[model samples]
Target chain A: MLIDIQNLVKDYQMDSVDVAALRGINLQVQKNEFVAIMGPSGSGKSTLMNILGCLDNPTSGVYRFNNTDVTGLNDDELSDIRNKHIGFIFQSFNLLKRMSALENVELPLMYAGIDKAKRMAMSKQALEKVGLADRMKHRPSELSGGQRQRVAIARALVNNPGMILADEPTGALDTTSSMEIMDVFKQLHTEGNTIIVITHEREIAACCKRIILIRDGLITSDTPNLN
Target chain B: MQQIRDNITKAILSLIDHKFRSFLTILGIIFGTASVIAMISIGEGTKKQAIAKYQDLGVSNIIIRDKDMTDAELQTVRMKFSKGLSVEDAKVISDVVPGVVSVSPQSEMKMEAKVGDRSAKASVIGVTPNIVSILNYRTAKGDFLTTDQYDRQLKVCVLGASIARELFSYDEPVGKSVKVEDQWFEVIGVMQPKALFTETVGELASRDLNNDIYIPLSTFNKRIPKVNPFTSDVKQLTVKLGNSEQLLPAAVVVRSLLNRRHFNNDDFSIIVPYELMKQEEKETRIYNLLLLSIAAISLVVGGIGIMNIMLASVLERTQEIGIRRAVGGKKKHIMSQFVTEAVVLSVAGGIIGVILGVTLSLVISWTTAVQTTITLYSILMAFSFSVIVGITFGYLPAKQAANLRPIESIRHE
Candidate 1:
């Protein structure tokens, strides 16, 4: 199992009032699986994505990644997991605006402590995989929305992590750019990379092989898509 | 090492992206460092000038001067059997005091020095040949008074540089005849121009040494009659010691001996140049410390400016920090990135400040009467202080940046 979570709970304090953002969520994701988490606003899917990406810790849970319990890991150890095992893509394409496409792709590898020459070679290969080889030197602002998403995908794939966590990966694109990003995700899935995308758009979620619906801090349904 | 290199590269890029803001942020550091260098250079120059002046006065020597008294006071001293300061006092101090090397007694009389049609008021001094060694006086032309001149009672004189110039214009005063107080004397030498004494030392009044003419003691006593009958035979005595270590004890003995010789009249005062030099050095050291602290305060103010800018920068880039943290950067990495940016800003400011400081010091030395010296250590100290200030003031901002939660910051608009 790449990720296994059981009885996960997350509580946030707001003005001295305890609000439960995630409560008793159980899920398992294996290697090479294509999963989509679907929910409305404030449905706790975003909080689950944050926990899955190691950006936050659950208040109470057993989160085991590659058979190692990660729930009790400290900040440094969790950062290591995020660097070496999990790659994240964001809805807004979260590419560092000051860096070139190649530099943005090299960010994860830089945090992984990879040497420079290898990092360059791997970033170049990843950009080429996303069909952005000729645009490697262009900054994110210089690229179109579709191209920027492609660059972000390159960054996500450069580290060759065990899984890729994307939050609303296609929510910022037009129909054409959204289709292009979906095709890239499908291509990545065919190459045996585990991909989990969080989105509310049914058309975007329908492109995934499996869909998990969440509502009000609870998982409502877990079903495999055959379309 | 690679991490640090990457952080530095990122910092440079970010600073370049916001060039005007970064420049404004380091302005305090630049002015602070420049002022530090300028102040230290000025202080050092003043110290060097003072040391040279004291060294020229002969650090191992003590001076005694006769009190300036009216004729009535002089008559009272004469009636009390005190002849003021005399050649006998010089002889007794050298002969009886331990650690005494030599003594030179001198008498001064103000009179008009005449050469041809030109006449200028000059202090005519009578001295033995030993005055040159005891007081570090040198001759610029010909030779100083010799033992032969003193023993033969020759009517020969040495003109001071300014006096020679005043009476002779461009012509050489040596081998020329100058008349003083109706006595004609041949000039054998011209003394070098000495530094001006702007302030009095003890009871000695400030006077321009270059406005004086020198004559042999025997000739002076024979040719120059006292305007007032009760005037002393000699007016000043310079005593040299073998080493400065015995200056205090020797001065004590000399003072007591003079008191006994004058029958406790207190008609003379002693001035030790070495002791005065030490006291001046202590005073200037306190002054330098005050200047340094003021400069340091400016540097600290500059540091606070940096911190203020950096804190604002961290707040402005919250989403950027979130992206870095979410992408796998640890707290240390984020911390180093901000710190490196702060360091780069301060170091650049330090370099520019050094250039400005050196220029300011040179301009001060060129345009003003005050001397300024730029030493290598002062430059290095200013530069290092700026760098330290950057790191020290950068800590709080960098910590605030590093401790930000990725989940919350990513959601921050």
Candidate 2:
């Protein structure tokens, strides 16, 4: 298994009240598995995704990635885990507006302490993978929405992370751009990349090989998506 | 080091992006450095001027002056002591004072000097032949009074430069005759221009040297009567010491000897030019320190400004920090990045300020009468101090930047 979440419980403090965002969630994702987490707003699917992405720690339970327990990690250690193992793609693209597409892609390699020339070459190849080879020098502001999302994808793939964790990957795009991004994800998964996506749209979720449905912080169903 | 270079490049880009903000941030540092350099330069210039002025007076010389007194006081002095200063004191000091190199005595009498159609009020001084060598006085014409002239009591006078110009424009004053209080004195030589002391010389009140006319001491005694019944015979004496180190002790010895001669009445005052020069240098050192401290305070304040701005910048760039951290940057990397940026900012400010300070000193010297000399050491010192300030004050902000939470900060709007 690339990611293993067992009996996860997460909570938030609102003033003095303990509001549980996730309670008793369990799931397992194997290497090269294309998984989609689906639920309506306030259904705790986002909370589950946060825990899975190493962006937030489970208040109580175990999250193991590649046989290493991630739930007990400290903030910096968790950051290292995120940097070395997980690649995140957000709904809003989250591209640093000040940086060019190439620099954005080189960011992961920078954290990896890769030298400049090698980092540039790796970033260039990643951009080429997303068919943005000619758009490397353009800032996010100058790029189209589809092009920006491609750069973000290139950044996620640059470090060769274990799994690409994306939240609402197609939320901010038109139909054509959405299909184009999904096509890249399909190709990445076909190339043996583990892809976990969080979304409520059935058509977007159908792009993945499996679906896990959650409601009110508990898993409701886990099944394969044949289509 | 490569991380620092990358950070510097990013900082330069950011500074370029926000040009006005960066300039405003470094303004205090610029002014602080400029003022520091300018202040030291001016103080050094003034100190040099004072030393040069004193050197012109001959540093090893000790001056003795007849104390200014009311007629009643003079009469009382005459009653208690034999009388006030006289040529006899110079003879006694030369003969008895162990370290005395030479003694020159002079007497002054107020008179009007006339040559052709010009007339000027001048103090006719009765000086021995040795006055020229003892006081470093140079003659422009004929010659100073000789021992034979003093013995013959010849009515010959040496004109001061200003008096010479006034009485004998275009004509050589030497060998020409000038009338002084109904006595015709032949002009023997014209003395070089002397430094004008604006303040009093010890117990002697201030007198203008420009109006002085010199004559042999013997001639003055034979030809002119005393201006006041109790007035000292010798108005002043210049005593040259063997070495500068012996100057204070020699002054002390000469003072005690004069006191014995005057029967314990303090009718004469001694002035040591070397001692006064040392005292002035000490005072100027304190003055220079005060200037440096004030400039240092401004630099500290400038540093605080940089710190404040950098802290605000870190706060504003929290998302950028989170982003960098997410990409694999360690704490040291982040620390070096911000620190490098800060150092670059200050170094740039320092270079600009050094250039500004040099220009400011030059401008001050040109626009005003006050002299200013910009030294290379001062520029280097100011520049290095500015860089240090940047590092010291920028440390806190850089640490704060490096310590930010990556996940939470990245999600910050």
Candidate 3:
């Protein structure tokens, strides 16, 4: 198992009242699995994704990633884990507005303390893989919607993390742009990259090999997609 | 180190982004440093001039002058068997006082000096031949009065540089005859211009030396009358000490000898140039301290401005900080980055301020007749102070930035 969550419970304090965001959740994700998490609004899908990405910790549970318990880790350690093992792609294509496509891809390597020359080479390779080799010098503001999303994908893959967790990766794009982003994800998956995307569109989820449906912070159904 | 370079590059870009705001922020520092350097340089320059002026008057000399006495005081002194300052008192001081190098007595009488066509009222000084070596007066045109001229009571006079020019313009004053007190005297020499000693000496009043006429003491006694009943025979006595450090001791010995000779009437007072020099130095030091404190306050205020902007910069770049942290930047890295930016700004400002300060000091000295000397230590001091101010004020903001939470910051809009 690449990720193991045992009896996870996440709660928020609203004026001294414990409002549960996720209650008694248990799940496991194996290596090389292209999984899609589908849910409606307020279904705790975002909260679950936050916990999975190490942006937030479970209120009470054991979260083991690659056999290391992550729930007890501190913020700095969690950041290290996020840098090393988890790659995040947001729906809005969260590339720094001031940086060029190449620089956006080099950010994670910079945090990892990689030397500049090697970081540049690796960033160039990541951009080429995303079909944005010629657009590496262009800022996100200058790129098209599809090109911005491709830059974000290039940044996510630059660190060679254990998994890519994208939340609504195609939510801000037109049909053609969305199809293009989806094709990149499909290609990544085919190249043996573990990918997880959270979205409500059934067609967007249909490309995944497996799907997990959640409602009200509880897993409702887990099954393979029939394509 | 790489982080610092990146942070400095980013800081420069950010400052360039808001050029006007950044300029306003460093204005206080600029003026503060410039003013500090200027004030210190001016103060130091004035101090050096004052010391040099005093040095020209011979810091090792002790002067004793005859006080102006009333008729009743003169009668009382005469009744108590006391004759006021005289040649005899100078003789006793030179014979008895230890460590005294030389003693010269001088008498002054305001008199008219006349050349062939020019006549000027000059203060005539009657002194012995020893007065020349003791007072450090050099002859510009002819020789000074010799012992033979003094013993024979010959009618000879030396004109001061200005008086020579006034009495004999374009003519060699060495062979000219000048009339003094309705008596004829040949001009022996022209004395060089002495340093202008503006302030009054103890018990001795001030007089301009530019229009002076020097004659022999024996001649003055024989030709000039004892007109003023309260006036002493001797006008002033300048005593030179072998070493400057022995001036105070010499003054004390001469004072006691004079008091005994005058029957403890205190008719004469002594002045030591070394004491006055020390006192002037003390006053100038206090003035320098006050100036330096004011400059220091301005530097601190400048530092505060830097801190204010740095905090705001950290807040504005929240997402950037989050991203950097996400990539792998440790807290130490972030802290050093902001600190380095601040240091770069302050160092650059320091160098510019130094240039500005030196230029300002030079301008001030030129426009006004003041002297200014910019030393290397002053520039180094100002530059280092700026850097220290940056580090002191940059710490809090840098720490605040380094301690930011990465998780929530990443999701911030």
**Best candidate according to TM-score:** 1
Please report, in order, the local distance difference test score of every candidate based on alpha carbons: 0.91, 0.85, 0.84
Cα lDDT for residue A184, model 1? Answer: 93
| Clash pairs detected, candidate 2 | A111-B328
Please write out the lDDT profile of model 2 over residues B1-413, one tens digit for every residue: 65556678878987778788888878878888887888888888777767766665568888898877898898998899657888888889999887888998888888988987789999999999987777778876778889899888989988888999999988977778999988999998888777665554334466667678999998888888877878888888988878888888888889899989899998888887777778889999999999999998998898888899899889988888877776666677788878877888788888888888889889989999777888888888899999999999889999999888766777777
Clashes of each: 0, 1, 2
Question: Stretches of candidate 3 above 4 Å error?
Answer: A190-192, B69-83, B86-95, B102-234, B242-245, B369-373
Estimate candidate 1's alpha-carbon lDDT, on a 0 to 1 scale: 0.91
Q: Check candidate 3 and list the clashing pairs.
A: A111-B327, A111-B328
Global Cα lDDT for candidate 2: 0.85
TM-score head-to-head 1 vs 3, winner = 1
Lowest summed lDDT over 10 consecutive residues: which window, candidate 1 chain B? B197-206
Judging by lDDT, tell me the better candidate of 1 and 3. Answer: 1
Which regions in candidate 1 have their CA more than 4 angstroms from the true location? Answer: B114-119, B155-157, B168-192
For A152-200, candidate 3 gives per-residue lDDT tens digits of 8888889999699999999998889988888999999888788999999
Deviation in Å, model 2, residue B350 alpha carbon? 3.7
TM-score of 2: 0.81
Clash tally for model 3: 2
Tens digits of lDDT, candidate 1, A1-227: 98899999999898999999888999999999999999999989999999999899899988898889988899999998888888888989998888999999999899999999999999999999999989999999999999999998998888888699999988889999999899999999999999999999999999999999999899999999999
Candidates' DockQ values? 0.76, 0.38, 0.39
